[model samples]
Target: MSSSLPSEKALVPFVSVENMMRLVHHIGIETMLAELADFIEADFLRWERFDKTPRVASHSREGVIELMPTSDGEIYSFKYVNGHPKNMAQGLQTVTALGLLAEVSTGYPVLLTEMTLLTALRTAATSAMVARRLAPKGARTMAMIGNGAQAEFQALAMKAVCGIDHVRLFDIDPLATAKAARNLAGKGLTVTSCTSSQAATEGAQIITTCTADKQLATILTDNMIGAGVHINAIGGDCPGKTELHRDILKRADTFVEYPPQTRIEGEIQQMDPDYPVTEFWQVLTGQAEGRRDNSQITLFDSVGFAIEDFSALRYVRSKLDATGLYQELDIIADPDDPRDLFGMLQRAK
Candidate 1:
């Protein structure tokens, strides 16, 4: 390692929430989600290379904060995110995040950016990607049980990636459903606001549950689900936070991102510890079967994982040069002599 500091290494590029929104608009939301899906798929294909583990977490009465980190031998990435289901009532996002990717050898941050909106985007992308594999062939309709910050993104990503053309939405809050319907108006999707979860799933082929309440809420009952439908359960992403009834898990061919973490944070947390689950990467890579037949119910127990954030960071970095949407922050200090930190401070004074 060189004793002298490199200018690029000392300055970290930061993408604020404002810039992240701008970048998404500049790239087009659906297009970015599609590209993000490509990046995520690429990473999942080579899953063994990256160091994967459960997130380090701290839980409070109001919410939970977590650090998700991963490395692929050369580069490393981590994201700081929070989940507060009640924040929306106070005019705040229920979830927010920031992420960074660094060179493993240098151990210096290279890129830093907001992940709140990005998390919604990637969560949707991950859901849509999984649905493409597990959904019934030529599935075109989706029943979205939760209509909140993540609802619109989930609808759009399904349309863009999974070729779903219609979305039926249901939410306990009518305003939320209206907001989601309005946002998705001109996006080339057929959107309908339903009165109940059962109504939303009336004719749907893919069912997506992303409710925000951090409890074991049964958004979908076993009798409500029929054979041959693909279910994307993303909201039940924390301890004691699950959306579907346990009977549904027993009937479906369940799949997950990381079993160790999902066992603690995902819907499967309700099941026995030794419950059988197929890792999604295997389905993506053709190593394991997804839906056996048209009538085989499939479930994706999605609890957001570090590898997804790592892939999102890499995707954002790849776009920076072309978009120039980041500002450099002087977060690290530089000295004429790396060994004389005190002398450098003395000279500055």
Candidate 2:
């Protein structure tokens, strides 16, 4: 049934990463991440309520690009994030991103924002949200295996959401680890630079792998991982890329964002097609168990799902609306006559 509603022709804003950083500074990163994590967890518990899809990836010799799109009956959102590890060599970010949010009712765009920074924030928030459910109690220390642009966000999110106060940081590039430590110095966490993945996991209850390697590198071996540790495997999100040894998956009870997507992109891809792994949403909703025992190892085989981006965009849209810190662009056509779909081009000329 169609009901009479006000025809509100409103233009939303486009926010850049710099503008987002200003907003983050005003709202505080901890608050932003905490709120974002709340949104993610809330959405996760209602997993069946969302319209989810696997991200579409475009691959190149240097790296890969991805488009993640999702909807929840009312709102539609999508993010464009590129992963070019070689971009860092040219002084550019390894992953650059932007996204759009639209109203499903009218198909009108609500907001467009740069997601390079927001992606890092959302990734960290998602990881922390999963850790809260899967990690052992009193989990204060974390081992960050890859210290890149995402390292600081992961460290801060762990501190903010999971109560992790100590981080043992490691990177093949000493400079990367140093940069992460410097960024996290006064963030109320004790940061340590470790020589190897084993050293980093020494006393850490949660180990996060955010490396950028494109190969099936085993950042966490079964020997280095201890019981009751929660592994946030983020880098092995693409096909052919992995961070944990296959043996580690056998030892730990693994959880994932989406079973079908993660089966292809996550570390579980190494295992047989019939390998058993639980969907994180199942645990969040009490349909499945998390951290079965104190001595059990838990792994979050994260592949950076579309739902995470959906939550992030929803949070960003709210903040941008509240602060009035965005610009509107005519990316969508609005014809004077509803039937004149092709008139936009003529009118522009």
Candidate 3:
């Protein structure tokens, strides 16, 4: 190794926000979303190999902070994130995160990256991956309620992974809807801004709710959702927050990433403890069914999960060599002599 290069054990690859954006632009956002879906699906297929748990959260009146951790024997990963809905009004993001990937054997970090953007990508990819299997066949239109930071990513992911050709957008804030519309203008999707949630759902085969408010708000009611459509309710991710009504859950065949977590945080929080839900990994592994019929309604009650973030970090690690978008972070202390820590410090002095 060159003297100029930091010790391998001390150097961890770091992808900063600028690098993440550059990588997204380098790979193209839609293409990256498609690729990420592939990675997420592959991990889901081998779901039993991982250690899964609900995120450990610290909740306050304003927002919640969480630590999501998981491992697949060979590698371990975790993410530190916060959800503060009122931050948007204060000129801050509603969600921000950082993630780490490490070797399970040595417990040494291999990569660290800003996941605020990556989270948006992974969440969109996760939704689209599930929609690919559960949405009505040949689905071409999507209704995107809550056009906030996550709106454009969800639209493009659906377009890339599920072949959606049109997206009808609605939001409580008109500016947010316009922002999403403007961002998605030339992305080969027909963008329509609707006056109401009902208008957005008209003639749409897939409905995605990604609102940011931290409350028990019903973005989609049972009457608005008809047969033969898929609902991707991603906004209701915490204990008190939900985007769909209880009747909708009762009417649809719900799927989830992890039930224990989703029951506490997802749309099904309103349902009984025994509310039947098929884990999506089971669907990918062919152990369960996805869409039963043309008229069947499939609801993916997504609350996000650690395995998905682990896959995202793994995907980023795989791309670091090809993209060279990461910098080596000297975060670990390496002593030349294994048993002479004090001697190594004195030698340095």
What C-alpha lDDT values do all the predictions have? 0.92, 0.88, 0.94
Write one digit per residue (lDDT tens) for candidate 2, span 1-349: 1112112343457897778888898899999999999999988988898888888889999988889999998999998989887888899888999998899999988888999899899999999999998899999999999999899999999999999999999999999999999999988999999999999999999999999878899888889988788889899988889998988999999888888888889898899999998998999888998888899999999988888888988888778657877766645555555576565446555
Candidate 1: residue 328 Cα off by (Å): 0.3
lDDT of 3 by residue, 265-304 (tens): 9999899999999999999999999999999999999999
lDDT of 1 by residue, 1-349 (tens): 3334335567899999989999999999999999998899999999989999899999999999999999999999999999999998898989999999999998989999999988999999988888888999999999999998999999999999999999999999999999999999999999999999999999899999999898889999998899899999989999989999999999999999999999999999999999999999998788998889999999999999999999899999999999999999878776656677776567655
Clashes (backbone N, CA, C under 3 Å), per candidate, total: 0, 1, 0
lDDT of 2 at 144: 95
User: How does candidate 3 fare on TM-score?
Assistant: 0.97
Candidate 1's C-alpha runs over 4 A off are: 1-6
TM-score of each: 0.97, 0.94, 0.97
Error of 2 at 297 (Å): 0.1
Error of 1 at 157 (Å): 0.4
Please state every model's RMSD to the true fold in angstroms.
Answer: 2.1, 3.7, 1.5
Error of 3 at 30 (Å): 1.2
Which residue pairs come into collision in candidate 2? 14-327
Residue 34 of candidate 3: its Cα lDDT?
98
Which 10 consecutive residues of model 3 have the lowest summed lDDT?
Answer: 1-10
Query: Candidate 2: which stretches are off by over 4 Å?
Result: 1-10, 340-349
